[model samples]
Target: MILKLVSYAGNLFGFLFLTLSIASGLYYISELVEEYSEPTKRFLTRAIYGVIGLLVSLLIFDKFPFKLTVFAIASHVLYLQNMKGFPFVSFTNPTFLLSCACTVLNHYLWFKYFNDVEIPPQFKFNPNYIPKKRATFSEVASFFAICVWFIPFSLFVSLSAGDYVLPTAEELKKTDDPTAQPKLRKRTINLVRVAINNVRGFIRSSLRIFGFKIAEPEYDRLSI
Candidate 1:
């Protein structure tokens, strides 16, 4: 019983540590990119074009399956649509959501293709014959890093959560009460900042549940 309890505790600790590490890294990258949004946007635009060219080259050389290569190219074209409002992404946008779905689909299809081994007719009858070797873990990982994940990861780092458009003076004038003060606009922060805030909030709540007093963080006052 003691051993089981210790194992559970260790697993929980490791999970929490990993989660915090990833969240911290994301927050740092998001913050850094927020400062150079224009340059990052330009670079990502060029990168998307380059990826498309790579896909075309692979297709021309018969390196990748024709249908799969075409699909990959189409997905990158969709990725370009997401750049219309670069650095200010709507999580609910159809184009953004579709691009995300394509990323997962592309990864799944390519991974399956790489891992599959097809035996020749002669090999099928011969017990000693072996099919070509499957892609190694390192090769699969590198392919995913360069082709499947590059754009999506870059977008995540460069895109902001969103910003509020201040109400126009003409619209504000249409309000029923001229004397009433306008409601405060909620401050916009990047996704990384939001994730950090949520993690901090969860920690505070957990501490409170354990009968410990925790002060609220002043993250709300700072701009991302």
Candidate 2:
């Protein structure tokens, strides 16, 4: 019962992790599209080339299982198609739909491969002679993290949302009601600056949680 409960919990956690990772990856892509559409496109183009090259090399070497190799090749091809008009497309676009299909197919194929039984062809009469093939939780998790699921997550991150744009300071200033624009006013710091400060704050907070006392950095004031 305990082992079963643990297995169930682990599966739940893994599902949640994948869901959160995909969501964050999408959000990161959305933000990139809002801020750096051109750069994002260039990066995705470069990535697709790398992926294609890698897939070709893998096919030539045939290091992975035949089924997985075929899936990888197909996934890369779909990824290449996704690079077309990348930063601009409705969710209903054929390329987007195909990419989504490829992502799920690739993930399922990998999962199936990982769970595959390696029974010998000659051991049909003796079932007990066949060796058990079991993957540990860590091995399965790492495989998904580094290989199977990562490609789709990366594709999600590389995609740009052409419809979304950061509001300009001029646009923010155009509001007649001052109280209504309080949030805009509060955003005085640039996104980059806020990100850096947030990172610093997180690091400090983490150190504090670990019982480590860290002195805050002091900036020099100009004496004119």
Candidate 3:
């Protein structure tokens, strides 16, 4: 009973982490659409190409599922549709909405694949010959980090709403400190800096847990 309870709790925590990551990813993409327009479009286009390349390689050399390849390719095409109007597209555009849905589908499929979770018993039609292949944990984690979660994490590091309103040259000369950052820019920088430090600290701690003697570096600034 205790082991079962622990397993259940672990699964719950994993589920929460996965859900939050997906939410953060979608939020990041939406914000990119709002702010970075052209650059974001280019990035997504390249990302889709990369994903297609990976899918093709997998098809040739790995036992990856066919349905997932189709889903991923379709999702990228849907995402490209959002770039058609160059940032003028509505959030409610049908293609974009469908892309979000496909994003969730991809997440679900990859999560299950990486975690080695079996299909639920009710859904197991062919009990004797179920496909059991799964990606290694490292592969899945790296994929999520680069392909799925990079935007959200980078947005946390780069977005500066307050710095949007720049001071004029005359206003800059009036300031006592010429080097002083705008309030919003300073705040955003601090937030990103602290976040990066905190992530470093967490990685250090986790490494220590695994018997790796990583030195914890002291930050000059406050960390989260």
Arranged by lDDT with the best first, the candidates are: 1, 2, 3
Task: Give the runs in model 3 whose Cα sits over 4 Å from its true position.
Answer: 1-40, 117-134, 147-224
Question: Across residues 1-224, which tens digit of lDDT does each residue of candidate 3 receive?
Answer: 99999999999999989976875664454545455645865765676677667766776777666887667666666666655654343345687567667777777876776677677776688757667666676887887776555433343333322223465677677779868875422212233444445666787889899999986566453433
Clashes of 2: 0
Instruction: Write model 2 residue lDDT over 38-153, tens digit each, in one string.
Output: 68668766766676676567667746676677767777777777767654444678878887887788888878877778676788678579476577889779756755566566
Native-referenced Cα lDDT, model 1? 0.81
lDDT of 1 by residue, 87-173 (tens): 778878999999999999998999888977777676788988867667678977986887789998888767776656567687689
> lDDT for each of the candidates?
0.81, 0.64, 0.60
Tell me the spans in candidate 2 whose CA falls farther than 4 Å from its real position.
1-29, 60-62, 124-143, 158-224
Best by lDDT: 1
| Ranked candidates (TM-score, high to low) | 1, 2, 3
Tell me which of candidates 1 and 2 scores higher on TM-score.
Answer: 1
Candidate topping TM-score? 1
